[model samples]
Target: MKLTASILLTTFLSHVWSFNGELAELECPDDCDCHYFRVNWVTDCSDSNLTRIPYNELSPNVYVLDLNDNFIKEVEPFPPDFKVRRLQLSANLMSELKKESFAGLNYLIDTDFSYNQIRRVDIDAFDDSAGLINLELQGNPLDDVEGPFVAVKSLLYLDISNCSLKRLNDRFFENVTHLATLDLSDNPLFVINNNVFDPLSSLETLKMNNCNLTRIADNAFSALRNLKNLELSGNNLYETNWGVVLENLILLEYIDLRGSGLTHLPDGMFDNNQYLRVLILAENNLAGLNIQQTIGKLQNLDTLDLSDCNLTLPLSEDAFANATKIRNLYLSGNKLFASDLLLALSPLTNLHKLSLSNCGLSHLPDTFDKFKSLQELDISHNPLNDAFVKLLAPLETLEYLNMGYSNLSHLAPDSFSKMTNMRRLILSGNDINNLEAGLFGNLTHLESLELNFCGLRRPLNATLFFNNFTYTDLTELQLAGNPLRVSKTGPLLPKQLSRLQTLDLSNCNLTFLPPEAFYHTRNITNLILSGNHFTSPNDLKFLELLPMLEILDLRYNNLTTFSPKELTLNPNVEKLKLIGNPWRCDCSVANLWDWANLEKGNLGILEGSTLTQEHVSVGKTKRKKLLICNYDTGTQPFTIVMNKTVPGRRPFLNPQRTLTATNRTWAKYVRESGCEQQPSLKRVVRSADGYVSVISEDGIKMRYAKHGPNTWSAAAINAAVVYVTLMAIIGVAFLLTKKRRAAVRMVVTADKRN
Candidate 1:
């Protein structure tokens, strides 16, 4: 019996040891968390304050590793037999990838080194036995696509986007023959040599979008025989001759030349490209469709986008006469008149989607009934009216229609009754003052409705009317930018729209919302309440009732103050827009800074928070002070008087005493002040010095001086008087004086002579 018991006890002890061993092998390290998913073990060691990998304590069966969102500065050596297949080392401070960094990862198939500070990679950095299939090095400081892909022959997908690569050598992609997809988009490659793509003949997808390429040299892409997709959009190729450059790309299926600065295409531009299916030439300077013959050659083309091409001239009817195979056409922003232009496109019966937004089309003719096969029509930004509704009434097959900004003020009861196949209708930006009860009752297949900014003054009631329609197919409803004021109006929405994932009521003048407003919308992922008058804190309770609200836009409101306690009430609010508000910035607002810092400072959200609180503090104060001082303060009091008497000096102040009596010797003082004073003239007696003095009625004395010396003055005065008297008497005494003087002279002479 003792021997049998010992055998059983030994067997039980062996079983216990083996079970404990398996559990220990499946457990994660003390610093990490581990879980078993299928046959692979996943471990997350992020933010564990780990300076290096604890290889000894880590489970041996771990195949997936996550070291993202950590402060790991360097990559330590891995375990000898570590078999990780996918590794994530993003959001770290790794500056360089050395030769021995990924030595032991012989089975790593996917690796993400994005969002790191890696500036350079040494040659043979990834020269290991690992079979890497997908490598993502985006969001790094890598300036060139070198070194990291030295021996990665099995790499099928590689993304080097946003890496500032200027020039690429032929050998850069020589060994990447097995690479099926390569993304070099968003680089600064201003100059590309002809042989830059010579080694990428086996590449199926090559994206060089927004690379700033001004010119494409001959034979630049002549070696890409198997290339299926090529994107050269957003370049500076203004005068590119596509005949010589893209003539050999017969196997190319998709080509994006949007924003490539090509105004017009030459004849036979795409004559050689018979297999091309999609062509994107939107946002260019092409004023007119002068390439009718060239576009006619593309018989296999299915999609053609010419939006925002500045097409001011009317489209020729023959432009799309041969393009009957096209299914989708985008002609928005051409400022086209719908009546004249749609007449030209009446022949395209196979067109499935048509966009004519911002074309200045005020009305459409009844001839629009020709496009019976069109499933989607975007006629927004046109001044459409109730009369224009008849034009679209024949389009019974339209599944989606966008009539926003159509200036439609009213809707006839049977306006949309014929559109039984319509799934989505966007009537936003219309002057719709009211919607009849059964306006959309015939649209039983409608799934989405957008009535935002319709200027609806009254709230939508009549729940019984909507119950008659099939609301189970409704998925999204947008009534934002209206004047739905009451809070109780929220529950008035159709209750059968339980599948609604998005609801927008932003800018609806909603001061408050009832809890039942979102009771049926608990599954909503996006809710918008921006641009409204939700000033009270209690209004935020509507958001808490939504357990799955993901995005909320509260822009342009009057939320002046916020607290951390208010924000904690809604934990699932991922995206919040609080821009354009009157938020107060003070010490109490510092909690927002802390929250933003903790959230890694997302720019869009932090922009709204910081704009009103921090950025608008000093600016608002300065603006207020400017407003106060802008008014005109009556008429500015003038202390310097005009047309008034002088204040102090009495002599100068009195107009009568302006000149003294002694000064009358120089001149007379004219009384020019008023008509009260009159002047008195008086004669004066002359002295020996020929001086004259005068006295006036007011006792004013005056003196006058002679014109010569003292002796000459008296003699001249006496001689003047004598001369005047003698001159008067000389007329009669002249003859007697002259005779008497002569006789006297003669008697004196005769007596003297005798």
Candidate 2:
């Protein structure tokens, strides 16, 4: 139903939109697409191969002018009269901002000029649009160019990062006093004098990270009296004596000074910052800090990060004595002994999140019973045993835990029964060969479970797998890198996971799956079965089982032809990967013309993604589609015998796109290409046009041109008739199944083989 409705809506919208010369009542440039969206005229000239802005042809009432991702060299003066409030000109080729370039954009409120080659800007370029509130000039080559921001005094946000700025005049920010946020990161400025930022008194957030700075004046940030958030990460601030410059910013609320060369903080480092809440000093030499005097004195601080500081064992018991309000602490990269943890963090009764990952601990301290509110914990990469699971019982309120990469081979039954509020569990990278029955019976609220690379081999029955998971809330289950394909003794999935939306069984070496494999997981929307060995058209039986599946990943599998009618597929599932297999684009491919409205230029191969959250190796650079044909038979002329004309009626996002006999014929394509011939079809009628048309209740059709030579034998005729009859039966069943399933319109890997 969702797929049908989406197609109907796309068809409707496509008809209502046309890009020629006018949009609604406004005139548009020939190279631009003008859309009357909501109450605004949005002119999109991005990636239109524009060499320069079409100042005269653009609509005067364009509310949002998008000229990004173009090759335009410069911005000319705006049209004499315009209402463009936002202008986007990023990823362009402009090298300089000439004077009076934007002299007429009075209504401009926000503008972006990032990712350009701009190295200079006239001081008065934006002088006429002084009311502009936000300006972005990042990813440009403006090393020392200044005075461009002298105008736009009402600017509230300005980003000038990655511009190689090495120096700033004493009065660089002389104007823009109303600026509330400024990002000057990725610059090469070694020092900041006190007089540079005197004009920006209203600034609230300042980011100067990744700059090679060795020293800064003590009063450099004094002008930013109201600054609330300061980011100075990735700077060498040791020469400045623990950055004495930060002492003047009394109203600071969040400070990110991670990776700074800090061995110890002065006793009065944060004395004036009473409102500080999040202090991130991670990746610094924090082992030398007197926690009792520095961080411990911040009574209102709630979050502190001291990870990778090489903290030793047996920290002073009064370490966080006065920091009782701290709620989130991270010491992930430091190796802290289990016995020393309690004494160090026992005072933080309000602690809610703690991360001690990669801490080289073999056990956990009798985790402080006072942490009644701790909700998230990460102790991964530790050599913890089955007994360590018992230590976490005190954290009954823990909702998220990452015990992945631990040294446990077995899951102690009922070990997690006390963590009733558990919502997510990550036990990846272990050797837990079998899951203990009823081990998760108490996790009534669990939603996501990841057991990737756990040496799991499944011949387990669904009934016994989740015998006591009374709750039906588990939505995501990742079982990548496990061998679940030997032989199914029972259903592959459990009923407790009926509501599961995402299931990743990738790289499982699966050859074939039974029709009932997904019988219990009918509600699954995203199914990943990539990196398996499914070799025949009969392997498509899974499609008949998953009615609600939306995205299916079958890359890197041993599959060849994809006849949608072989085994009916849920029209809701759109992408079927046929990459990495020897695709014989024979007459069977023509079968796709009737079911798949294979867009002429769209030959499948679509871009794939690499970002994974469940640690599944989906490193496929591009999702393979059924495109490439065997070069030997690349032009092998074949005849497609159609019975009758069945006009394609699938109304989709592209209403103007349709497959017809007049558009293209398979025989015509074969004779035109210069590929080596394999002659998959007989030569007697090979020259005849191969046209295929299909779709019927239970009947099949084969209509060929009468231009072929009359060289048919009795045996050939019998074989042709038998083949057509068998296909007719399959076609009838296909339509019946699809019609019953859809109750609407029945229209709709990765490897080296493609």
Candidate 3:
């Protein structure tokens, strides 16, 4: 089961001055930089080492002001007409929030004052900033009296968690009545007074998780009628009967009570939560599970997570008799016997995703076919061998299957012939070395196949994808950690993987690859060939066959220098992984170094800002490994010649890595790494008269190299052009000579007459 949570981790953002719509440029404060992000004018002043907020110097129309991680100690009032919408002031040194600190910022909607040394917050601090909607006061040591944000009556979201809050006074939220979400997690709040949260009648989500909370008055949350999501996980709620505490919360939809050290879930604890859809009771020390009382009363429960509850089975056949509507059930990390587990789960035919990993099972019940609606199944970390092959073939509806480290040894050739609907299959960490011909031929819809570390000993051949003519839809294939090396006389990759986009063959103990190794893989865009034994970039000649290749990973190879000339040949490739190699920052790498500077603006696109801290570009790089130069050239001034022009003819922006690009780290290395090139060697020409001589552009002789590859070169077109140009020059000379002769004859006749 996948759990996804989005926590807003506000980071430091340096600002530049620009309007949102027209993006008109304006002078920014010396301590700030601003840019237009999405639909707002964000001016980030973070990490600027400023002692105070640049309120007077900021743009009047700035919508977002980020001053995080600065040396500011006080919150000064903004300009009277400041229209800032989101203000971030995390990691500051302020000790107290004084009144009128944010007086005139009527347009401020979201603000963060987290991680400050604030020991007190005056109740009137937010009286003038009534328009603020979301407030964060986390990571503060606010031991002062409560009722701090009583003035932010319009606040809708508040995160006062992790503030070392021991207790909240009765009037803590006296004026904030419209709050929809409150996070009080990661605090030392030990007790809850009666009717403390009774004022938040409109609150929809309340999170008091991980607060070391031991006691709570029954009336503490007695008035929150609209509360829908109650997450009280990671707390000590063992002292109270949570059923009585949550008896009035009728609108609760999702409850996470994981790791609360409860021995049993009292009957009807969630009986009043008729709208509950998901219930998580994982990591609890429950003595015995009475599912009929835990989930039987809920008609809308769709997901139940009882993983790691130390649940053992001999469960009654009717344990989940009334909870048949649950579709996603997670029983992983439990030690249920295979037979008893399958028997208990047999009634839930509507299950779509079931995770039984680490359940110590050696077989898959053929009865799984009864769950015709099941799509995703994970049985990893079990001892199930090939005994479960045919048992799983009946589940035609399964789309995703992960059987990693299941002690699998071998399977029949047509083991998965019936699972044509499978989209992703992971069988990594097994001993199934040899694959039969047409093994995956029937899985036409498979998109991702991972077989890493499967103990394959022989070089791959066509039989791996043999007769799989319709398997072109596979986009990702990870065969790393296997010795799938190349042999001189072995078979090449089949053309069936023509449409494959990403292929990983890393750590494959590969030393050499023939030039035509991947000649059939034309559309692969991402290729991982890292952790190999390639000593030179020339060993990557097979890349020429991958015209559509873009991202190439060559890390941990025995490479010394990657010639920029190779990069010039492969223009489509952009993001390169050359880390973990002994890279010499010299003439052989200078052009690539310069090229990477121009290209690095494309990396780190996961963030809104690119790596360059300059202009944004398209085609973001996905690799996170930073390329470092291993050989540090000393500060000695040694002369080295650089090529005036790169060999290939292409535009300056794209293929040519020789373009002048800025590298902020260039000062650390010697610029004299640019060295001179050897003089060009004269080609040997074998003349038609049987004598060898130096080559000329004239159309008589054929040139030979010091080595031969049993291949011939064609010069038909170039030879024809050279011959035509020579003929035209001779014709022009003959015409001029004829005219001079005629003039001389006329002069001689005239002299004879005299």
Candidate 4:
């Protein structure tokens, strides 16, 4: 009896397992892949070359379905009781939406039909979508939109922007009472009626920018009492009384009126907006704004932007005197001098960030001492030099400074010694040729330094961070776009820079790497050395010591070979960039291929070689590693591969024995030359991989094939021909002299006989 019971139990368990397996397979559709998360399955059918929705193949367990980038024309009725909560049908050819299109999706909450041919949405299209909270109809030609979302009363966010909307009325938002955000930008609306937004009383943010609006009615925003942010920028508004229009928005905290032809800010414009914190008036013709009369009322203001305004009147002390709570002020792209700016900002003691970039400031005024609490300052695109930089000594709390594009050619020693608390410094886009040691020694807490686009010829000494036995806390340093060359002595990094994490030296015109180049930056993980002139394997021998390096960029260099012995990678390296190089695909580059394909390193080599007989141009060789080896012999080029038996499409490897021999020959030749070329014997380096490097007496190496159309080979042949022609000419001259002597002796003998 017990045995019988066991057999019955086994049968039941097997049946249950089979039923569960069927359910799991049923949820995954044939047209899409399903992935299960915490609650339900997400079906990804995007970019699947789909022409129509496989409604019958979809299971009810699918919650989120992505049908983006398809060729479907219309939104067919969904399956009955469809459990999909979100449906994406963007980038399709659908033109219109019918009323019963989404009738069966009872649980649908969001729908995206953007980037389609949608021209109209029926008023009752969303009648069954009472639970729909978000709907996107952007990038369509729905110009005469009247009212279609009356049934979508649960909507919270609506984006009908960029639909060529010309006008809006109260009927458009009749039932959207609970909407919190509305975006109607990129339209052609000329006038805004007062009661259009009256139904959306709970709206908090409204964006109507770039609408080509000409005028706003007197009480246009009087209905939105709870609105906190309003953007009316990029309009054709002119001579509009904003004070009366914005009088009812008592809860407004942010406003943007930029790119509007508002010549002036009328008096008492912001008097009612006591809680306003951010006000942007950029890119406007605000030459008549009396700062004291227009902006003095907002006592709670914290940030104000007035950039690109052609100010005609000089700012006085009374400007911004009432808005003492302002913490960030921007007056960039103006013609204000340092003295006028100082006078305007002398009363803003609570300011923390100030941008006076492109103000033509040549010097700092004495009134600049008022920025006691400032932590960030931008004085870029000016004419400030070392003298003006010294004027910033009073800002003890300053941490970030930008002085790029300022024509600063020199930085005197101890110029920035007073900014002890500074953490980041930007001096890019300058004509600085050199920086002395200890120029930033006092900034022991500095973290990042940028000196790109400067005419630097050599690396700065390590003493810049030698601050009384305490190493500088610098973590990032960028010296790109300079001309730091390789020195004969050794590498140019300080051993004490243990905290450094990132160093960018790209486009610096470097030629070589002295063995211990990066021995100091033990903690460095990212090193960018692209767009330089490093050509030989000897230039990368310093990478072996960097055990913590995670990313190494060697792109756009003149490198022709890569050997594991010279370019040893750390085990932690994850990415290696080697694009834009004249990679010679032969036994010489075998180690690099092995390293890239290794399983332990898991290195991602960007744009390595693929087997191809056709040679591509250097610039177009991205994602292709092809070369024209032995091409000038008037023969068809063959694909270089590791073995002859490998399939045409499979990757092959070079023999390790041949690869090691090629490397040994190269090293032996380099060592025999004493790492220096001999002056007497013209050094000719022959590689077993089928090329020759001719090193001149002056220690310059140029490569040429044994029999190919290389510039170096052509030049060498021409030189040999010139030497042979000169020797032949000298031999003929000697014979002529001997003949002349014999003729003269005969003439003397005949005279003696007479």
Q: Pick the candidate with the highest TM-score.
A: 3
**What tens-digit string does per-residue lDDT give for candidate 4 at 221-255?**
88889999999999978856788988989999999
lDDT leaderboard ranking: 4, 3, 2, 1
For residue 263, model 2's alpha carbon misses the true position, in angstroms, by 1.5
lDDT of 1 by residue, 441-548 (tens): 777777888988888775455442357444666667888878875656456355556667777888787777786676655777677778888786667776666677
lDDT of 3 by residue, 1-754 (tens): 0111111111101111111012355434644545545535667666557789876668888877778778899887777788888777778899988878877777878777888898887876777676888888888987846454557788898888888888888788888888898999888887777878978999999988899987777767789888899998898877776777888888888889888777777887887888899999998876487777677878788998888888753566777888889899988877777567667788888999999888777787657868899999999889886866678888899999998998888877788888889999998998988777777777789999998999876644567565547466788888899977467642256777777898888899988788777776778899898998989877877777787877888889999787545655566665777767776666555455444422221222212221222221111111223344544534333333333433211112221222122221221222323333222212333222233334322324343333232211122223334445545655666677789999999999999999
- Per-candidate TM-score against the hidden true structure: 0.64, 0.69, 0.70, 0.68
Order of candidate numbers by TM-score, starting with the best: 3, 2, 4, 1
Better of 3 and 4 by TM-score: 3
lDDT string for model 2 (462-575, tens) is 443346453577788889988765554335776777788888888888888777888777888888888888888787676677888767777778766666564355746555
Show model 2 residue runs off by greater than 4 Å.
Answer: 1-50, 53-67, 146-148, 241-244, 459-469, 481-491, 506-515, 526-544, 547-754
Task: List all candidate RMSDs to the true structure.
Answer: 47.3, 18.1, 19.6, 29.5
How many clashes does each candidate structure show, in the order listed? 0, 12, 10, 1
Clashing pairs in 1: none
User: Which stretches of candidate 4 lie above 4 Å from their native place?
Assistant: 1-49, 54-64, 78-85, 128-130, 148-150, 457-460, 467-472, 483-492, 505-517, 526-754
Worst 10 residues of 2 by lDDT: 609-618
Better of 1 and 4 by TM-score: 4
**How accurate locally is residue 256 in candidate 4, as Cα lDDT from 0 to 100?**
92
